[model samples]
Target: MLFLTSRLDHTDEEVFKIKQLRQLVEKCDELCVGTDDTMLTKFLHYTRWDTIKAYQAIHAYYEFKRRHPTWLARHSIEHYRPLFYGTHCRFVMPHVDRDGRVLVIFKTVDGFQRFPDYLQSLVEMDDLIFESLLLLPRVQEKGITVICDLQGTTRNFLRQFSPAFMKVVNEKNGVLPFSQRIVHIIQRGFLMHVTSTLFMPFMNKEFKERIFTHDGRHLSKLREMVGYESLPAEYGGPASNVLDTDLIFNHLLQNADYLEKLQKYEKL
Candidate 1:
């Protein structure tokens, strides 16, 4: 939406394809979204370089934004400061895995004490973080790997995942113009079973298959998949590696302008 010049070096054929895709986008007068080569390239990559599918994905993307105005709005730092400043539950790592995919981690601390009040804000904040991550050229190219750390999770936290919220999350994940390579769930006990029962129904077949469950003792497997460099010290990475909530928050603040511009693309 910000119309960034593509940093991704494109091959001749890819450049040609992007031009073709751009034409399709321009022709759709109703879309009203101002996208650049980089954004178009992301759609191409998301649809595996098929011009038609990329256009369709673009249409779906804008339609999604139009449908969810609340999520699309309020990406500025001031809007999120009060609600999410101290919240460290979800953030993208500053590192990438061996295959270059970005790492996104979500941990449940205690359940939200004010669930209903924070639900919309929480969804918008998560979208802000995710959208910021997607703006990175490398992240768009390589996609993302999600780490669901359910270590400190409790039944209370689990209960906060309402069906309506899960449905919106599923829809958001589906329409977002990025790939979710895999989701690694780190948990223990019967809670994982209960958690699975509660949320698995909302997931599509491909996403469900992408999830790999690991018990507390099986962190080694997680390390093997994500690599030590990509993880935090708490999860067995280097001693210096840590989850810096401030860093994530600061990054979002830095991109506030970009996020603000994105809101304009939504159909009123």
Candidate 2:
């Protein structure tokens, strides 16, 4: 069966790649049962469809998950909601962009604290978002666009963005099915810029290419990229400034059964 495309309409090239990836994954006993077409495609995309690279990517993914046991604990959305309450971190404007990618806005609020356990919570929260997105068909294929608002960011908060934390994020990005199209850093301050410089070296070339920095002076470029209507009022758009995190939490609740079924096919 053709995994990446519909059987009836799959092209010869698509069929060839799918078969190639499937056969390689099947050879890896641990990856055989859990891996699916969508996941195989994700690895292939990450590795530029090179069979060896794709295999390595798949293995690396499971290995990372094995190392991070907490990520596999299957915690509910509520478990991570406290980390976001009254914080600048949020998923604002529940809508897709012109390219069909989901837009997640993360604003930096005052009183940012980075406890030792905060890194794990951040990774878990990211996984929950990914799980929620997986429930929607074609959403994974389209990927995500992240808007990082750094207006109120302080040196203390920036200092907490350590290399260890970035390594976790980098590893997680590889395993996740969805791609991050762009990480738009808006309203950047001196500290935010310094943080970006420190973290950029650890990221892959593709990820670095997708990182765009912008000051608060004018958001015309961002508006054009994400579409003015899709942005919230704070970002010079018509959408509401209020971000309802519960809406996403409720989404996770409502789609629990569907997400559970999808989990059976996930690689991580």
Candidate 3:
């Protein structure tokens, strides 16, 4: 509760708005005092302190989860080992950035055959990461910064970027509790630009502003924005090695017990 009040200097109108949002969210779904305060605050902040919009966002968030039971259910790292073993998507840098947002890297390679299943795995990984962050009181207020490394991406890989995949991405981007600080697309190519432009209409102005595109020449700019030390070794940073599937899988497994405790606490 102190974290909630400390983050923002609320005016009389804002206080009333927060109270209204809290009541609405609680009516929509049971909220634990410890956990749901932060969750409620996120929705309100995302909607720019607009109670009605926050209510809509809260409703959409839970609705999306309910519709996708596979994404909503309890899933551990072991459950996703096979998918992780085959992909390079993982949360790198054990710490948050200067702005306190968690750094996640999705290195796209050229061997994914089933995009839908892979997309689900990505969603599951995000759920685990976000849930884990929620458990850590210090970082609960932080958002996520996704660095998409499309280095070796080929035409085949780009083919999987279909309308269905884009729909899922847009839907999740719209409703998640935490804000997306940036979806930094590095090593940008023609396909990246083309696809992003095509989907630009789907994103709000705020989200569009957060979508930064950088080429190889702009490594310094990328470093400046995200901090050099937080990046992978391949990106000219201090991280000794690039984060692969195995490293992420192990990291998730290591924190499994703590994450479970936090999740259970939220339900209480």
Winning candidate number (lDDT): 1
Model 2 residue 240 CA deviation (Å) reads 4.2
Scored by TM-score, the top model is 1
Q: lDDT per model, in order?
A: 0.76, 0.65, 0.63
Could you give the candidate ranking by lDDT, starting with the highest?
Answer: 1, 2, 3
lDDT of 3 by residue, 218-238 (tens): 687788888876777777778
Worst 10 residues of 1 by lDDT: 1-10
In Å, residue 222's CA in model 1 sits off its true spot by 0.4
What is the per-residue lDDT of model 2 for residues 196-221, given as tens digits with 9 covering 90 to 100?
A: 67777888887789888787778888
Candidate 3: list runs displaced more than 4 Å. 1-56, 67-74, 113-116, 239-251, 254-268
- Stretches off by above 4 angstroms in model 1 are 1-8, 114-116
Clashing pairs in 2: none
Error of 3 at 238 (Å): 1.9
